[model samples]
Target chain A: MEVAEKTWGLMKKKVLVIEDNADHQAIIKSSLVSRNYLVVCADNPSDALHYLLDEKIDLIILDLWLPEMDGLSFLKDLKNVPEFSEIPVIVTSGTFGSEYDILKLNGYGVREFFMKPYDPAELVETVGSLLKKTVD
Target chain B: MFYYTDPKRGRDMKRQKRVFLIGLLAAILGYLWELYLIHSHPPFIFVKIKPTWWMQWVILFAAWRIGVFISGLWKTQPTASSQKENDREEELKYLSRIYQDLSNSLRLEKGKFEAVLRGAPDGIFTLDEVGRINFWNESMEKLTELKKEDVLGKPYEDVLTFYSTGKLVGFEQGTMEGSSSSEPRQAVNFFSFNGDQSLSFLEIDAEVSGGKEFPAAVSVSTLKSPDKKNTEQIIITVKDMTAQKEIEKLREEMIAMITHDLRSPLSSILGYAGLLQNPKLCVSEEDRQKFLTALIRSGKGMLLLINNLLETARLGDGKVPVISEPVKIKMVLEEVAENLLALAKGKNLSLSVEAKDNLWADSDKDKLHEILTNLVSNAIKFSRSGEAVKITAFEKAQEVVISISDSGPGIRAEEKEYLFEKFSKIKKQGSTTGLGLYIVKKLTDKINGRIVVESQEAIGSTFTLKLPASKKASSSVQLSLVGSR
Candidate 1:
């Protein structure tokens, strides 16, 4: 039974959500937690960096507008780090995503882009599929 | 040549001829008298006068010559005086002709200069050496609503007041009493302080007639005398910044609405509502309740933002109606506090109100409630957990005074000037629209009340609102609802 629990723990994927809005953080956490994934939340980029340094995060959910630094700058900082560069990121924004923003995110190897007012079910499915692809 | 053509010289020649004729007649009469004496004179008179006919003829000829010489001397004397008078007349005529030509050219040049100033889009005026408005252009007239005849020779400070960065500028003290040296010095100081060069545009606030104020870009140039040491005149050019300011405000508002205000709340609402709807996800009853509450909160926030936007537009168009009536100050304060209770609780702040007994104000209840709600909510938003937001009301000198105080990170002194300006967010965080205080100020002004803010950095802020007290004497005093469509 100990070996089985260990295997189960190793199989679960961890997601770090960097969002300022409490409601968005809670909803995303609930959705991911129900699917048996580990979720860590940070409300700012500094805390997000601390979380990234402390743990082996498999995926990242980033909100664009943040308290200390914006998500794009944080993402660039993350990409520069060899340890966290391999983690896939899905960007969500409150602004209407322009084509230029999408292209820029794609250039940064963003896994997905979601404008606000997005459906939570769709987001969960995308998260699942992106995580599975990373595993593959 | 002038002497020959002169009418006065011709009159002198005629007078000279008359004198010669008179002399000749007198000489002929004397000659006839001699002849009579020679022919039939008394024997004794003939013996004393002449001896022979030859001697008598010689005397007659000599007398005629002497009379002609005397006539010549008289004519020359008159001619000298007449020649001086004629030369003076010619000199005066020539000078007058030159003067006419110079004045005509000067008038043409003046017309062109005036036309250029009048047709210019900018407001242009000139201050003379004595600090009076000597020239005011058409644009200046249109801008200030003061005619040239009215403002000409008036002191510039009395006609228009200019402010640079919220401080009065562009005029020195004692300018109205004709203190000449100080005005040019102040103008030069104002320009040189703004730029390295003497001429540069300075953004200023111009207050015109009827106490109306607008943003203006003013450029100052001194018209120097030939020596360049003293400033002869100060030329000011003003461009209206109202249109540019409006465009900039609209752009900022659109960006804030699209990026933050409208979308942030909508994002929360959608995310929370979607989570609640997804049955496949095991949301417990408690989680469900939390999600529902968040949804309601976001919806209410969005509704408030939309209403504030509509109110701003209506207020801009002057379409909002004001129906002033007696309202109990304490009751309105309680209603606003109740409306914002949840917001305060969410932030872990306590809301309190203090008012005198039977405190009443002459105001519109709905507007008063909105103003109080905005102020109280702003207080709660800025405060830390466990801090108290206080609302106090009292009667003082026939007026109802209400103040909202919060122990938040108080606004910096520099940020206070634009605190009530549209979209002037000192701290850009969260879902603040930055329109709350602006709307509150507008509403207060619309209802004929005054709002004042006092704050210190890291201490707190208090917004005091004053309104007329409810009294029978003031019941007949009606508010001029000119803004209502």
Candidate 2:
């Protein structure tokens, strides 16, 4: 049996929030900040692509609708890359049509989805829970 | 006709000639009668010598001159012919202008009506009681992709069958099937169809009347223009609410996405936070417990958020069903109190439920339990340490009122409007999930109950839940049905 490697130090997990709406971005930021997580905001898919290339993103908060390229395609493109393929993307959308779009995103290995008017407390708790589950 | 310069205007000259002939004849006849009297009688008896016809004619002409002088009756019409022609022309012009003005306004009104009908988004069609399509609008033509030639005068059922499949589908079954011989009105039915071209859903509401049926689904409401109660024809207005539906769809998607996305990384954060709570990690005992407590708090908060999202969705779609059955309220209350005891203990609040035996209600067990749990938990959460959380059950004539009152600072008058609204909580100096009261009210309403609030902001708030006398009536109905069977 291969011996399992263990690390003693706590690694800060980086969160990439790809949302088109500015208000929604603010909500994600405030909740993640309260939980003491490093959150990065990208308002469009192009910016998200640039961030993914430059930064080692641990998880993603992706909105399904974005200008030019949407979050679903962004998720698919990132997943296609060997190094970034394993990153979990949580899809968020404000419309029902976009929700149906998220179902397609799920096939791309999205972890979960958050609808807007989301509770700030729930956002914090869910993020904590998702991160905790990953570590375990 | 009298000779006049303009012969068409000879009408005035003819009238003057008729009057002159009558005057001359009358004067000549009067003179002849005087001459006969003089020849027939003696000198003393006979009338004095009377003027001849020519003398009388002179007198009549003098009288005519005097009338013309006083009233100017014979003023020139530029010769009477021109006057008559001018008057006739003016009258004809007035009549023509009135006719033109009326026709123009009528045309404008018709054009306005046609414009409105064409521009309206809802497909409007008129159907007879026998289900014949009599009138179809431009919008209706576009909506069904059928031209007026194809649909007008065809039976609606035939159209529905042709569109749906080869079989006849009894399109009017819901509305027409339920008439008792004496049942006054046909029941209205609302139906929805998703078009094949795109998945756009069309809602149809139809009504039947006086054998002249008018059914349109957009509003699903009877048209208000013609009073079905009095008028022969039923006019229905179909309002296209596609924009409204789109907005609602957008809202639903937003909620779903936000909730889903928040859960992903939140799980990771919570997982790491929980790891610190392990004593094996060499963390201090106090630190371990603190992290664990924080983890639990965050988990609860997240659950509360998710519950709010779900509740909002359910409320909008009207999908919440009230499943009521005979269940003991006392048992439910006891169970709620037991579950809440631990939370109450933490605050040192005396949580107790007061109920009488044999108190039963026919209600959805799950919903009742939820109502009780929310009230009890809210009472314990809001109360100060050592305060009391009381649950009391009593009966009114048709309902049983269950009240949960806490001694914590109650709701204020200003906050009362939003007390049961989603995410609304009393501003307390502590951690709280404002969804409990909202769930309480919503669940209560589902079970056909009312919630009354009694509160003084500084003292505390009391929530009284009223449930119907469902047990007796529902049980009897079930028994009667079984007996009939």
The true-versus-predicted C-alpha distance at residue B221 of model 2, in Å, is 36
Supply the TM-score for candidate 1: 0.59
* Steric collisions counted per model: 0, 48
Candidate 2 residue A95 C-alpha distance from true site, Å: 22
lDDT of each residue in B102-143, candidate 1, tens digit only: 899999999998899988999999888767899999999888
CA lDDT, candidate 1, residue B311: 86
State TM-scores per candidate. 0.59, 0.37
Candidate 2 interface RMSD after superposing interface residues: 12.6
- State each model's TM-score restricted to chain B: 0.50, 0.43
Report how large a share of the reference interface contacts model 2 reproduces. Answer: 0.00
For residues B1-485, could you state the per-residue lDDT of candidate 2 as single tens digits? 22223366444555555455544465555555555654655543544655566766665566544433433244443557767887788799889999999999999998998778666777666655445667677876655566778877886655532111111122243333323443233333222211211222224323221222232334222222243332222223454445666667665655544544345335423443534533323445564564454445445545545665577678668888888787777778888887666557545678777766667776888888878877877777678777888887766787878898988888878989988976563446333445667778878888988999999977998999888765543221110000000
